[model samples]
Target: MTIAPQRVVTLHYVLNDEQGAVLDDSRARSAPLEYLHGHDNIMAGLERALEGRQEGAELTVTLAPGDAYGLRNEALVQEVSRAAFPMADLTPGMRFQTPGDDGPQIVTILDVHGETVRIDTNHPLAGRTLHYRLEVLSVREANRAELVKGHPLSADVAASQVEDRKVP
Candidate 1:
């Protein structure tokens, strides 16, 4: 079946950066990615590219910074009091997931001063072009539960387990 809203799609992908450096490979992890189509579960550019594809389809797509993670926002970089962090050893390049205005956001440490820490909230891949080689493994109608959750659910999860499951 063609990929569309309320459908679950399973695919393997190799993701690369503009420098042609491999960033991620689903095959290498021995796991295929599964998501609910039209639910914002994957990158917009990638979802658009797979819109009309069916099982066994293979395609390559390239996305600009805007289409992928979006351009880096300078405003996202700011300095907060070092006391804000519970950790004593504040070092550059450390990443932490913190609550954001929208949801969970990744904060990357740029520098640590005597009493302030500079952090960047932009996504790690922000402002970079990405390339993707995708192979569709399967496409099927999403079950009622999956559709309501807005993503694919593990087949091995029992009904009771699903009710208690929390995605973080």
Candidate 2:
């Protein structure tokens, strides 16, 4: 069966930036990453690419900045008082979560200027093309537990789902 919305998918992926530097890779881990498609568990572009693909399929996709994290907005970068982050040492490249109009947002420190800290609210991968080498390991209907969790069902969760539906 093809991977579609609400289907549980397991895949190993290697993500690289424009320069070909590895940003993240699931192959280095013990298990392939699993998630429900069209649930925002992964990037929209990647999910769209996975649509209609079958299990054990391997493919490479390149996502433009807009399709990925989107282009970096200069307006999102601002300088705030250093005192705003009391716990952090506050250095360039350090990331911190701050409250924004939308909600909590993670910002990376671009520079430190005495009492002021320049933070960029854009995602680290923003404004960059992303290349992904993906191998789909499995595809199956998402169990109730997986649907409820908005992710793939764990072994325990899968068992619990079965038990929950048993005649009592």
Candidate 3:
């Protein structure tokens, strides 16, 4: 059957950035990504590209920043006193999560000075165009449990509806 709402789709994909750097290759992990279609389990660009596709179908698609991780918001960048983070060795690229007005948010360390730390709350891929080479591995009706969970049944990718949002 074609990939449609409530269907579980398994796909092997190679993800790249505008500079042709490999971002993710499912083949290397030997675990294809699986998600429930129309359940907001992945990026819209990927869902649209896989719609109506069948097993073994291969295609390539490019996603604009908006369709992928979305444009970076300047407000997400904040400079706080170094006292804000007291745990562990602080360095660039360190990520931490904290409770926020809209739930938990991840803050990535951008730079650090003697008294101030610069952090970005935006997703790591925000504002970057994404290139995907997709290989449809399988498609089938999702089981009742999977449909209720709003994701696939695979243990490798077990995720709740809230956790599966706008992944590119």
Candidate 4:
């Protein structure tokens, strides 16, 4: 059946940057991700792509910077004094969370000078297009347990429920 709103779905995905650098992949010795559809669990573009797809389907989609993260803004880059950061050793490429207009935002260290630290508030993937390779492993009717939990029921749990409901 095609993926529909309010349905629980499970899938594996690989995400890459414009340069083909692997950002995140569900196939890296980890379990497939599960989430309730239309709940903002994944990227907007990805959610749109899975709207009408069924199980065991594979799709590759490319998303622009605006659709993925958003274009980088130079104004988001700020240089502050090293004293602002409590860490004794501040290094470039290190990321830290700080307050922003909307909420908490991650800032990456761009450069570390004698007593000054330059940081960028933009997302690391900002201003770059995103590429995703996804595979829908399974899509079945969500049972009562899944509905109650607001997510997909685990395989073991689903099996146990089936066995419990069997006639003697």
Candidate 5:
């Protein structure tokens, strides 16, 4: 079946950066990506490109900063008192997950000073163009449990397993 809302899509993708440097390859990992269509499970631009495609379809797509992880916001970079962090051995490039206004956000340590620490809340891939080579593996109607979770579940998952997940 063709890809559509409430459908589960399985695809292998080779993600590359602007200079054609390979960033990720699903095939290399031996696991294709699976997501529920129209559920905001994947990037909007990618879903738009994959919409209407059927199993066995293959295509390449390019996404700008806004379409991908989004543009970097300078305001996301800020300095907080060193006492804010619970850890003592702080270092540059370390990442921590902290509660954000929207949800959990990754904060990357940029600098550690005597009394303050600089952190960047922007996603690591923000402000970069991404290229994707995609091959559609399968497209099927989402099962009742999958629809409830708003994402695809593994085939080996049981009914009890689905119920155990803390799905909102």
Candidate 6:
């Protein structure tokens, strides 16, 4: 099957920065990434580039920051009182996940002062361009469970969903 909406695709990718620095490589791990197409499991630009592609297809794509992790927003930087995280030594580069209205928001510590700690809520890759070398390993129609979950469902979970279903 071709890589299209509702299809599960397995692909190896080598991610690099604008300067050609290797950022992430799935090939080194010997495990290709598998995801349901059209889901937000990956950057939009990369997914769009693979639509309608077939197995063994290889391509390299460059993505602007906006199409990738997005531009960094200075407004996301804020200073909070030290009392918020009592007994813990907050240091730079430390990340904290706080429950937000929608989901957990990851905020990274940038600086620590006596009574206040400064944090940046932008993604670590924000404001950086993304370069990707991708090769499609395989593509197949996603199972009903995977399509419903917006991701790959484990075999156990798929079995449970099957048992819970009541056909009319």
TM-score of each: 0.91, 0.88, 0.85, 0.78, 0.89, 0.88
Taking the tens digit of each residue's C-alpha lDDT, what string does model 1 give over 59-164? Answer: 9999999999999999999999998999989899999999989888899999998998999999999999999999999999988778777888888653645666
lDDT of 5: 0.94
Local distance difference test values of all predictions, in order:
0.93, 0.89, 0.89, 0.86, 0.94, 0.89
lDDT of 6 by residue, 1-168 (tens): 688989888999999998999999998998889888898878889999999899999999999999998899999899988888865777799887888776777889999999998989888889999899999999988888888789977668878888889686
Model 2, runs deviating above 4 Å: 98-104, 161-168
For candidate 6, give the lDDT: 0.89
Question: Ten consecutive residues with minimal summed lDDT in candidate 2?
Answer: 82-91
Q: After superposition, how far is residue 25 of candidate 1 from its true place, in Å?
A: 1.1
Report the C-alpha lDDT of model 4 over 1-168, residue by residue, as the tens digit: 778877878899999988999999998959888877776667788889998999999999999998888899999899999999998988889998888888789999999999999999999889999999999987666777666666777779988978988999
RMSD of each: 4.2, 2.1, 7.1, 4.8, 3.8, 2.3
- 116-141 per-residue lDDT for model 5 (tens digits): 99999998889999999999999999
Tens-digit per-residue lDDT, 1-168, candidate 3: 789998999999999999999999999999899889999889989999899999899999999999998999999999999988887579999998889987677899999988889999998899999999999999999876687778887654444533665476
Q: How many residue pairs clash (N, CA or C atoms closer than 3 angstroms) in each of the candidate models, in the order given?
A: 0, 0, 0, 0, 0, 0
Worst 10 residues of 3 by lDDT: 155-164
Winner on lDDT between 1 and 2 is 1
Q: Cα miss at 62, model 1 (Å)? A: 0.5
- What's model 2's TM-score? 0.88
Q: Give the distance in Å from residue 127's predicted Cα in candidate 2 to where it truly belongs.
A: 0.4
What TM-score does model 5 achieve against the real structure? 0.89
